[model samples]
Target: MEMIKIENITKTYKMGLIDVHALNDVSFTIKKNEFVSIMGPSGSGKSTLMNIIGCLDTPTSGKYFLDDISVEAMGDNDLAKIRNKKIGFVFQTFNLLPRTDALKNVELPLIYSGVSSKERHRKAKELLTNVGLGDRINHNPSELSGGQRQRVAIARALVNDPAIILADEPTGNLDSKAGEEIMEIFSELHKKGATIILVTHERYVAEFADRIIHLFDGKIVSDENVPKNNREK
Candidate 1:
């Protein structure tokens, strides 16, 4: 049931003559349908770890198995294809196209996957409806509230029926009420059996996850499961 296996992963960056080690021998496993949070202060390699998990970047060394596939051995083209087919990303910035409508935004992935226009429309409409934005299908990102914009992003993320949802500080730009609403959507997704991995610095936001993995100096400092009763509070 392990969907992700990361072993002795390390990432390094070169800034001029100086080399920065973003991650160092980090290892972990994430089970399917698990809602987990990655937390750390600035420059702790949490983001670097996330990039590795999401297949946006490769590690400088070590092995990563995503759904049993060896990520480290895959070429850039293969990695891009896997990323398009398997991972769904939700960014804090609600990275929607300003000129596109909700339906269009959600359909972008399907278009890339070569889905027919008729089928694409059907799928996109269904996703928007599921995300509670059916009526706003034609609304552009500018017209929607912050929470609604995030909802559209979520819909877009789910458009391809990805195996995992990777949300990076998804509610950081929203107000408390809006943030709570976004959390509720995530809760619903988890209830319906979606695997979620979120990256955040806020303890309150991290509390929404079933387990939390704290990163410090490119290593896992703590990985703990939340008690059942404290999930929502």
Candidate 2:
């Protein structure tokens, strides 16, 4: 069961008269329930690749299939539907609404999907509890610790039961302890059968994924499975 498949994908951007190749002939497939990471330095095209995988951007050439559905032809409205139903996103900045409480932030996906108010509330509470934020469900992002805010973000990402979790630099802002905590939560999610694709520049962060795909100069330089001994679990 291939959850993501891309073939010879390319992304080109024009800055005035100059052309920038963000991704060049990249190809890969991620299977259902697999945990994979894309590792690269700044300006190495990892962000561009992440955008394409998350349906936030389209390739200039080649094909993209998300759960066997062709994404190359989807319009903005269609992409929004797929994003709400099939993809969950966690960003380094903890992209939560500052004015909202943790529970409300976590219910965003459900709200977008037209879930009933009562049910969405229940699901948000359950996910917050699962992520160890049960005691702080009513707190605003300002009231929580950095790690706790991220936990809220993780809860929000899972609120709608998305088929894939796309985390971009998810642990980039955290301290060592907090970063490890986030990775532990991700490991737990993978244990429960979620397909995860994370993009990061840190080796330790990338190591949390079962496999690491190294990107350089808009190309895959290496794709290797993590050894059992190297994994956190």
Candidate 3:
């Protein structure tokens, strides 16, 4: 089943007297539980596409469907609800609150979701444990290692059991070892039937995905399956 459908999507930004096209008639469909990566250089349309897919930004033209619902027609508030309920975002910055403990950070989403404190704590603990952070649940982000902090972010992303996970350069800040560890966690999530859409320019990281969508100058150049030989066993 298709979980996402983007058709002829275009994003144009008005800068001064000029119009900059960030995404040029982009189109793609992501099936449920499939792992995909979008790769491009800094100036490419990858980030723009991710924003549209995650509902952080809307397109200038064309249609978008999420789980068969017309996302293109949704209002701002509706889009916010969809983001909270259906999509999970993992950012490179490990965007946790410095003063908050891992548990509370993971629970933040649930708090906004109107879950009871007791239930939120329980779910947070479970997610923290799932991400190998059970022992550090009480530790603040300032006290955690870079990798651990990213793990906490991952836990938070999964706390809502979202239909899709959208990660933007999730391993960009980590060292090689930590980056590999993060990729391993993503691999585990994929094996467990989680749908993941990761955006990264790193070749090794892109290889971790089942399919890769290559973008250049606001256009998709290619979308292809990862060669079996390139796949991690």
Candidate 4:
């Protein structure tokens, strides 16, 4: 199934008298349960594309369909609904609230969705355990290690059971070993039928996906499947 479909998408921003083309006629489709990576250098429109894919921003022109629903025509409220119900975001900076415990952080999306307090706590705790943070559920962002905090972020991302996991530089802030461990968790998620779209500049990180889409100057330069032999075992 096509989880995400875009065609001839374009995004333009006005900087004074100049119109900056962040994305120019870009098109691609990501299938259900496919693990894909997007790679690009700075100023390559990677962030712009990610924002559009996440429904945080809309394109200036062209078509975008998520799960067969037209996204280009959605208003702010509808977009917010899609974001909360269909997409889960994982950011590099571990966007957990400084004052909230890991369990509370994980329960945020549920609170937005109007889930019951008892159910929210149950799901959040389950996800924290799954992410190997069962004992650290009471820890705040400042109390946990970089890796543990990211793990909590990941657990939060999964708490809502979103259709897609949109991760932006998820391991960017961690040490090599911690980053590897985070990638391993992502790998395990993919194996469990998650549709993951990861955006990163690092080759090793990008290679974690089964396929990679490379962007340059607001256009797709290459889109190819990772060779089986080239993938890490």
Candidate 5:
């Protein structure tokens, strides 16, 4: 089943009178439960593609079918709802609320979805436990280590049971050991049938994915499956 379909997508940015093409006629399809990475150098359009895939930005002219729902024509309100319900984002900085505890942070999404307080607390606790952070559920972001903070972010992302996990430079700020631990969590998530699309410039981080999509000059340069060893590594 194709969870994502991007056809001839293009994105152009206007800087005063100059026009910059961030993506040009890029097209691809991602199946359900697939782990994929988008990699490239600076200004190579990997970020732009990620934004489009996450529904943070729409293409200039193209068709995007996310789980058979047309996203190209969605308004801001509709897109926001889809973002909350269908996509989970993990960022390099963790993006946790500085003053909130881990459990509260994870429950934030449920609040947006209009879930009851009791159910939200239950779900948040379950997710935090699943991510191996149940003991730290009451700790704020500042009280946790880099790895623990990222785990909280991951738990928050999964709180809504989104269709896809969109991670952008998720390990960028962590040390090697911390990064590996986060990747292990991602591996477990994939095993449990999460569709993951990771965007990164590090080969080591990208290697965690089952397939890699290389982007350059606002276009897809290569899309290939990773070897078994690579996937396991």
Candidate 6:
């Protein structure tokens, strides 16, 4: 049931004459349906690790297995296919196309997968309804509030029924109330057996996850489970 396994993962960047180590021998395992949060301050390698885990970037040297398959062995085309099918990403900026309506935004993944128009419309509408945006499916990103837009993003992420939901600072742009609402949605998703990996520096936000992995200067500093009492109810 190990959804992700990383061993001695290292990522080095070449900058002019300097070698920058983004991740240094980091290792971890995340089981299926576990909610995990990765925390770090700026330049702490959180982004680098997220990129590797999301299959957007390869580790410079290490072993990465997704669902028991070796990610390190995948070609670029294979990686792209895997990313589209297995990993769903929710970004801080809500990455929706401003010109597209909510329904189209959510249907983007299915479209890429060559899902029939009728089937795509059905699935997208259902997901948007589940996320509390059924009535606003025709609204563009520009016409919706920040929270509503984020809901659309969440719906889009869930459209593919992906094995893992990689959410990076999903509430970063929201106000206190809106952020809490977004977290509530994530909590619901977790309850329903979604495997979510959230990256955030906010302690309150990180607390939503069942476990936290703290990163500093490209290495894991702490990895621990949250006490039941500390978790959001």
Against the hidden true structure, what lDDT does model 6 obtain? 0.94
Error of 3 at 135 (Å): 0.6
Q: Please write out the lDDT profile of model 3 over residues 1-233, one tens digit for every residue.
A: 99999999999999999999999998999999899999999989899999989999889999999888898878999998888888889999989988989999999888878899999999999999988998999999999998999999999999988999999999999999999899999999999999999999998899999999999989999999998788765
Give TM-scores for every candidate, taking all chains together and pairing residue i with residue i.
0.98, 0.98, 0.98, 0.98, 0.98, 0.98
Q: In model 2, state the lDDT of residue 1.
A: 97
Model 1 earns a TM-score of 0.98
How high is the lDDT of residue 225 in model 2?
98
- Residue range 60-160, candidate 1, lDDT tens digits: 99999998999987889898887888899999999999999999999998888889999999999999999899899999999999999999999999999
For model 2, how does the per-residue alpha-carbon lDDT over 1-233 read when each residue is reduced to its tens digit?
99999999999999999999999999999999999999988888999999999999989998999999999879999999999998999999999999899999999999989999999999999999999999999999999988999999999888888889999988888988999999999999999999999999898888888999999999999999998788955
Question: Model 3 segments beyond 4 Å from truth?
Answer: none
Q: Give the per-residue lDDT of model 4 (tens digit) for 178-198.
A: 999999999999999999999
Query: What is candidate 3's TM-score against the reference?
Result: 0.98
Give me the runs in candidate 1 sitting further than 4 Å from their true place.
none
Computed on alpha carbons, the lDDT of every model, listed in order, comes to 0.93, 0.93, 0.93, 0.94, 0.93, 0.94
lDDT of 4: 0.94
What is the TM-score of candidate 6?
0.98
How well is each residue in 108-204 modelled by candidate 5, as lDDT tens digits?
9899999999999999999999988889899999999998999999998898999999999999999999999999999999999999999999988
Evaluated against the true structure, the overall lDDT of model 5 is 0.93
Query: Tell me, what's the RMSD of every candidate?
Result: 0.9, 0.9, 0.9, 0.8, 0.8, 0.8
Clashing pairs in 1: none
- At residue 203, give the lDDT of candidate 6: 93
User: Model 3 misses residue 12 by how many Å?
Assistant: 0.3
Looking at candidate 5, what is the lDDT of residue 110?
91
In candidate 6, stretches whose alpha carbon ends up further than 4 angstroms from where it belongs are none
